[model samples]
Target: MTTDSGTRTPIRWGVLATGRIAESFASDLALVDGNELAAVGSRSPEAARTFAERFGGSRAHGSYEELAADPDVDVIYVATPHSRHLEDVMMCFEAGKAVLCEKALTMNLADAEKLVAEARSRGLFFAEAMWMRANPNIRRIAELSADGTLGTIGQVRAQLGFVGPAATARLWDPMLGASGLLDVGIYPLTFAHLILGEPVSITAGGTLSDQGIDVNGGATMTYASGAVASIAWTQVAHSDNRASVAGDVGLIEVPARFHHPTMFTHWHDDQLDTISEPVTGRGYAHEIEEVAACLRAGKTESALLPLDDTVAIMGQIETILDQLGVAAR
Candidate 1:
């Protein structure tokens, strides 16, 4: 950011967790030229110290409280688990720091709304770190979609799946809001929402573990525009992780790992057009840039990832979980 006197300043960032995702985010934070990782916090001081030393945070706080209270930190990235997102977001708000929280923003729709409302009430900047929304290729696709590139998209399909270690507490433990639903299913849900808007009707089917966590699921969302988005996610199998949007006149296909694509293709009348926009540094830098841009412009919420949209996506997930009987523990 450029000050009135022509001095450039980097957004000073603080990270609220030292988990694997936290590390990836921090590593990418360094790639954005106008951002700086100045602080890190973890429940364990040793963990904080280790992450900060490795990730370029100048300060290491033994607790989230200390990190939140740090005056030098202009923004905080809450990379905690889905269950902890609301709490961590509020903590940063209470400390007067701008926040970029991980998604799905909270465990439920009501909680997601509560976080946004409180952040709004305090006149603080808040946004969910849905990185794909800020991806250049996705933004271009959205622009083209709105401009009738894929005229009247009647169908959309998206899927994300992986077979991580089965026993990971966050993946199966209901107490930690464990369900493949929130953990990875959110990608498909939010992707659908971005392309098709909120669903007028959501039909869901899934395989649920005896312990009450949904291991995998498929959802069909119908929009008032006569569009239907078919979404699939799983933790027990490896899926193609691709997405496609189709309409009467043409088709737009995002290749494997669509949510994190380097480019996308458009097909029409035997003609194909490809847009290539490679990702930078794990692709988290774009999201960090959004936070910085919003904060520098003094905006309370991001236009790309609106507060209402976050809650709406949460509501859709809530509905899916209800249908699958995958309530949290």
Candidate 2:
């Protein structure tokens, strides 16, 4: 059911890319009841037209500038590569449009700070599309931890990795802000931050490509709470992509894609309890709904994925990058 405002209208959305991730998000947006695809934009006019036609958008623009300028677009989803997020988001901000940009928010903390400051000064809605934070299961995990069901989380272990076919693809290109740490490693790092808070000490070891990007990296985060998190990310190997949160009482294991898993299990003593919640589409609808809900309530940030948390996460990323001797372009 669609949550109704006084006017009972769906939030209008403009998609700002034609990549695979963009298409996945657009397909999920269709499943959301209170959101409408108003437009799509791409560097290639034909790609934009095709995407708009398939997604039922009212217009397709050959350039992001036009899409951002379209008055009918209530919010813009910047789905471009991390290297281009700053440029794309600034253009939308210039047009007085709200934005939900893909994660890792930007190539580095400086850009993230700039974007957040601009959004604050302009009083415009802006969010890093960390879809996992907006997920129901992750929220449940947070709640369980808060309620002491986890009995004080002692450690968090998470890993995300995939074998990339293109050594020169965006995932492997440093010039394009392609690295396992930012692209995939952030998942485990963010998950650790979410559960264990900021760590006091960080150590990272990784194999760097000729382009100076991390192909595989592992980090150990030691928090002030005495809790430890071992997180790893890679583009050269296939991992289970699972996560485990260990506490005094027991542990919670997320099967796969721990970031967006359908179900998780809690092992307490001799009992193994499972919680399952199926999501529709690709699970992107959850975040889309969150953005619409915030906009309708006239909030500049999401309660779930707050701006402060985003900044803190970016800071953690910076620390990790510095340790790895890698710099974002």
lDDT of 1 by residue, 35-148 (tens): 999999999999999999998889999999999999999989898988888788888888898888988789888888899899999999988889989888888777877788
Candidate 2, residue 201: the lDDT equals: 91
lDDT of each: 0.88, 0.90
Off by over 4 Å in 2: 1-7
81-139, model 2: which lDDT tens digit per residue? 99999999999999999999999899888889999999999999999999998788888
Native-referenced Cα lDDT, model 1: 0.88
